[model samples]
Target: MILELKEVHGYYDKSHILNGVTLSVGQGTSVCLLGRNGVGKSTTMKTIMGMLNPKEHCKTEGSMKFDGKELAGMKSHSIARLGIAYVPQGRHIFPTLSTEENLKVAARAGVDGSCKWNLETVYTFFPRLEERKDSKGDKLSGGEKQMLAVARGLMQNPKMMLLDEITEGLAPIIVDQLASMVQNLVAEGVTILIAEQNVKFAMKVSSDCYILERGAIVHHQATKELTAETRKKYLGL
Candidate 1:
């Protein structure tokens, strides 16, 4: 497994978010965390990225390992340098910066010091971003901003990507485009763990699915095995 979590628990103030949540993503495969809003899908993503610090009130517990290295107490930047890139839900691009600048700010070689992604190569992979290279982030549409967000993460030359709710609040067409983009990344051998509410899109992109409810995973199965009955049972879809 490229990423593994065993009985991982997370807290926000006094509110328990993730209750012994466990999941794994293998090398070069895509996994989806399927849940409704407030089901701790985003919390799982944040926990894996080490964004949830062990504050006085908020804390994280249990094992989170990536590439055999423990990530329970590591800082967020340290985790990023270890080849795990996070494309958060909000498409958090620098609003004033140009598209090229946004990508450049995240540019870094892989952990092995190999540079598989750079400005030119990333532009080629995301041709729409190439077309808008000179445009400021705030000027782009929703879908364009999402593309830039994913592209910027790729600029890090990461081995694995943690995508949190990337398909929320988008048109169906845009969601389809993003799905295709994610598929291309998996084909290029980038392991992905996506937290998503859009079941159709999630089912289309991921090989395995974990249904999360109230911070606990209620179901784990291959995507091909997810029947409509199962979706309705856990997801109410």
Candidate 2:
């Protein structure tokens, strides 16, 4: 396994958001965390990213291991340096910076003999980004901004990526493009953990899926086994 979470518990201030969440991800595989809104899916991503402070009431219990290294007490920057890249929920891009500049700003030196993902590579994955290389981040459409966000994370040359809501609030065509991009990334051996509300999209790209409800995992199964009836019942479809 490239990543493992053992009985992980996380809280935001007084509210306990994650209740003994456990999950794992293998190299070159994709897993989707599925749920309705406010089900601790995003919180799980934040916990894995080390954004929610372990100290000062935002408590985390259990263990998080990345490539055999314990990641419980690491800082957010340290976690990033350890080859974990996160594309946050809202495409948080620097509005004043150009698309190329945004990617450059997130680039870091390669680790573990991994090739550094440069502008050329990101452009290859998202040609729209290449077309808007000189355009300010604020000028791009919603889909373009989301693509840039994913590209920025890739520039860090991470072994695995945690994507939160990659296809939220986009047109059907744009969503299809994003889904194709994710499939390509998986084909190239990048481990992906995506938290999404779009069950159809998630099932299309992920081999494994976990459904979360009220900070707990309600169901987990292979994507092929997820039925429409199950989705309608558990996901309120």
Candidate 3:
């Protein structure tokens, strides 16, 4: 497994969010955490990224391991340095910078300097970004912003990516495009762990699926095993 969380709990001030969430992402496969709003799906992503300090953003306890290395208490930057990249919930990008500059700022040499996601490589995978290379982040559309976020994360040349809410408040057409991009990334050997609400899109791209409810995992099964009955039972679509 590239990423593993065992009985992990996260808290926000006095309100606990993630209650003993446990899941794993195998190498070269995609895993999806599905749930409605405020179910700790985003919290789970933050916990794994080391963005949540103990009892601060959340009380982070339990094991978050990547490649068998401990990550619970490590600094967020340290975690990023360990071949882990994160695309946050809001698709936050450098609003003042051009698309090219945003990607450039996120460029990292990687731990071994063998990373493969350079500007031309990222551009090849996301042609929209290439066309909008000179546009400032604020000038781009929502879909473009999301693409930039993913591309910037790729620029880090991570071994695994933690993507939160990849398809939120976008046109269905844009969502479809993003889904294809995700599929292509996985086909090219990118390991992805996604927190998403779009069930069909999630199931289509993920190999494994986990259902989160009220900050806890309520159900889990392979993506292929998710039936209409099961999805309705857990997610009430």
> lDDT: which candidate is best?
1
Off by over 4 Å in 2: 54-56
Candidate 2 lDDT by residue in tens digits, 101-199:
999999886567666588888888788889999999999999999999999999999899999998989999999989998999999888999999998
- Name the lDDT of candidate 3: 0.91
Candidate 3 lDDT by residue in tens digits, 1-237: 888899998888888888999899999999999998889999899888887775454578899899989998899999999998899999998889999999999999766686689999999899889999999999999999999999999999888899899899999999999999999999988899999999989977898999999988999899888999988888888
* Alpha carbon lDDT at 198, candidate 1: 92
The weakest ten consecutive residues by lDDT in model 3 span: 50-59
Candidate 2: clashing pairs of residues: none
User: What TM-score does prediction 2 earn?
Assistant: 0.96
Q: Over all chains combined, what TM-score does candidate 3 have?
A: 0.97
TM-score winner between 1 and 3, please give it: 1
lDDT value for model 1 = 0.93
Q: Give a tens-digit lDDT track for model 1, residues 1-237.
A: 999999999999889999999889999999999998999999999888888876656789999999999999999999999999999999998999999999999999999897988998888888999999999999999999999999999999999999999988899999999999999999999999999999999988999999999999999999879999999999898
Better of 2 and 3 by lDDT: 3
For residue 183, model 3's alpha carbon misses the true position, in angstroms, by 0.6
Q: List the residue pairs that clash in candidate 3.
A: 11-58, 11-59, 55-59
